[model samples]
Target: MSEEFTYATSEGPNGWTIWQVIGRIDVSTADEAYASGEEIVKGNEKIAIDLSTLEYISSAGLRVILRLNKLAKKSGHKLTVCGAYGMVKSVLKDSGMDVLLAAKESLDELS
Candidate 1:
């Protein structure tokens, strides 16, 4: 069975909305991730996707990140990602998404 994918949101310092993505984000879960991310983008000006609990991410998952970036930009909002480690971090780096996502070491960097 696939690992259940899930995400949560919280308020961060400096008016940033924190979205914490958890579990595997493969083809099966990418669509949901994108939809939910879009909703969050619509509601907030500053957004951060915290990958601290994320275990795996596929190319489809990367597409979601790119889509969110576009949506945030089009809506005149700020978006960043942080706390990626292990294989999740490697995948983002290898795909050169780390730069596009503006990956940060932690949430405090946003403040």
Candidate 2:
């Protein structure tokens, strides 16, 4: 079965663009989500991702986030993720990416 994922972007305080991701992010939708993030990171200097609505994420999805985080750093932009909870946050913490990416408590922390 195919799952539906929604991705939207909005302006945050202090020039950061917040990308709100909803639904499950798995192999089926990881590429799309990653592309969306890449486009924003390419055009904006500050990017924040909100995962509050994200219900589930697979390793593929995590890879996409890691890639975007690396790209953001390489391009001299900042990438922050917030609102991760339960399994989503557990995966990140277990993989040690939580520290590597320097995830903030919220987008406001980035400011």
Candidate 3:
């Protein structure tokens, strides 16, 4: 399998933008992940990070998410996480990031 981590953005309902995270986010990619997500949150008022295609995320990845969340809050923007499944979902839940971030089970939940 490929080890590439990339992002795709699309307009979402409820005035939110969907930032789809594909591939893995670990120590090696965490910086890039944060940079990319920071840019997204800066440009949009509402963001929903869709992680359905995400395969893995390390603690570094979680840190990136948390930072983005804080950035959004400080900027008066809204940020939410959605579409997490399997190990990704488990990690978010186990780490309590799910509750802290108010992560949704699916993008539809945000809609």
Candidate 4:
């Protein structure tokens, strides 16, 4: 068995894509994360992953973020990480994903 997690996608202010992630994100759940995010980004120009509620993230989770970043860039969209705190923020910065996700301290900055 594997750990469980949950996520949700919604529209943010200014027509941005918002993905709210919760629980642990590891190898087993990376696919789900990717799929959900992929769909949320459809026909959207700005994407933001709300990680304030997320507890943990492994390399696999990082990969999911990277993939989203690539897709957004290829489509000429912007991807930002909104409210990434504690370890989640550290992981993004440590892996240098902050450059790709452009992790923002506030949701307002994400727009």
Q: On lDDT, who's better, 3 or 4?
A: 3
Instruction: Write candidate 4's Cα lDDT for 1-111 as tens digits.
Output: 226779877888887888888887889888988888888766678888898889899999999888888898888888888898898889888988887667788777754
Supply every candidate's count of residue pairs whose N, Cα or C atoms clash at under 3 angstroms. Answer: 0, 0, 0, 0
Candidate 1 lDDT, tens digit per residue, 52-84? 999999999999999999999999999999999
lDDT of each: 0.91, 0.87, 0.92, 0.84
RMSD of each: 1.3, 1.8, 0.9, 2.2
The best-first sequence of candidates by TM-score reads 3, 1, 2, 4
TM-score of each: 0.95, 0.92, 0.96, 0.89
Clashes of 3: 0
* lDDT digits (tens) for residues 1-111 of candidate 2: 227678889999989899999998899998898888899999999998898778888999899899999899999998889988988899889988898876776666758
Indicate whether candidate 1 or candidate 3 has the larger TM-score: 3
lDDT: worst 10-residue window of model 4: 1-10
Which residues of candidate 2, in runs, are more than 4 Å off? none
Instruction: Note the residue pairs that clash in candidate 4.
Output: none
TM-score, candidate 3, is 0.96
Best by lDDT: 3
